[model samples]
Target: MLKTQFPLASIFFTFSLAAFSSPANARSIAIDEATRLPLVKRAQVWAQPTWIDNTFNFDDLFNPATAPLGSPDEQVLTKGTIDCTYLYEAPNGPVGANPKFKCKTTAQPSLKLKVKYGTENGEVRGEVLGTRLLWALGFFADRNFFLKTTNCFGCSENPVNQKQTDPNSATTPVSFSPSSIERKLAGSEVLKLVPQADGTTKVSQGWGFEELQMVDAPEQLRDREALKLLAVFINHLDNRKANQRLVCLDGSSPQGCTGQTVMMIHDVGSTFGG
Candidate 1:
């Protein structure tokens, strides 16, 4: 009789523990000021910022920088022809498996392209979807454009298979058959090369997730948690330090981020899939 009662008590205690630790129960806790994020509407997050040019900006358009800093220019390229000069292609990988290239475009000098060809399950579609969802939810996301066709000047015959001999040299032309790409995505992830007074170009290095702990008064704890939860919902498995970026909108230099810095996930390619 004593042994049976002990076992029953143990089972009841385990069940109670599990119930208390569940997410549903945890959300019941009272919200505090320190943890609550400021009032944010789902629609307001989709408003387009004024500054679209990611390159050089000297005019008064840079003033009155808004909160939730978006990329300089955030829009889709569906109308005109996208002519790009192939700069370089990154080494292939498994986690964020996709053919990506650093190309210089007429509109955006520093443009990153994700190409989808053959039978590849590339991240172009997933990335575009993920960024749009995040942007709609009031988060800074890369300005992505899906182009059905693009003219690649000085491109390799088989770009997807082209291996990089030297990743440092930007001018080294890997010419093939001048690739005529079909189904590609253009996004903004490169640092802005702002010209300084000393006749030199300055670029700010991006920040990692660990920097969130150093977040000042502008960032709330709930905001950070919301991002993490969103990542889970989007099935963003490759949520690493290199994929996330923290940029500044001080409008000074590429690295001049003294005013208001915005945290965004540039690489959402490995998302929206179970």
Candidate 2:
């Protein structure tokens, strides 16, 4: 119960696979404006499923917390106060942090604060646990940490758009109680082709993005497919583009240098127990 499902409209993506090409070659992608989804030709389902890479590492995330706890004024890492006035973009929407705040520190140049309250208390835990699981599985998930905080700098500021976010709305807020503060990571995982069961062959890559009206380079479709599985495992029900990003695979693909694109899972707060 960690996600909020997007509208179940039939407006999902479709693929145009009339022609075939090598797994590494760039291809064309089309979209249906009515559906707002892409058109891609899917590969025939394989019984053996030779698309996934078996190699993965989880040493950094699984480790126990050892850093000493401190308050925001004292610069304690385990916990701290967020200067919300340094606000970036508080959409005043329920898509994410009620009022996402910016944090500027020497070690963490671009950290953000996300608060969870009432029934959404599990959001913090879901985010923490989901990060570990996705990172281990070798899919793209950004860095986020769950922490407790009582201070919110901009807790009572008047909102910019009173209609999008009513002053008395339960979901929109300038400040929150001891909340779930999530620190944005410096960077995250990349998408690339994995060696097939044969050990050296490339099976699948790339997907068509209808929103862009262009089919991009090939990516081991398994990587994105695996994300679907990871979401299920973490109980992430809201896997919409609102929580995802099409990021560059960073030099990790078979080419050993950055060029192609991959679907990056940027938000996992919708996992765990939303």
Local accuracy by lDDT, each model: 0.42, 0.38
Q: Cα lDDT of model 2 overall?
A: 0.38
What C-alpha lDDT, on a 0 to 100 scale, does residue 20 get in candidate 2? Answer: 14
TM-score (all chains, Cα) for each model: 0.50, 0.45
Model 1: clashing residue pairs?
A: 52-72, 52-73
Best by TM-score: 1
Query: What's the TM for model 2?
Result: 0.45
Q: What is the lDDT of residue 48 in candidate 2?
A: 24
Q: Write the per-residue lDDT of candidate 2 for residues 32-58, one digit (tens) a residue.
A: 222111212211111121112344122
TM-score, structure 1 vs. true: 0.50
In model 2, what is the error at residue 260, expressed in angstroms? 4.8
Q: Give the distance in Å from residue 201's predicted Cα in candidate 1 to where it truly belongs.
A: 22
Considering every candidate listed, which one attains the maximal lDDT? 1
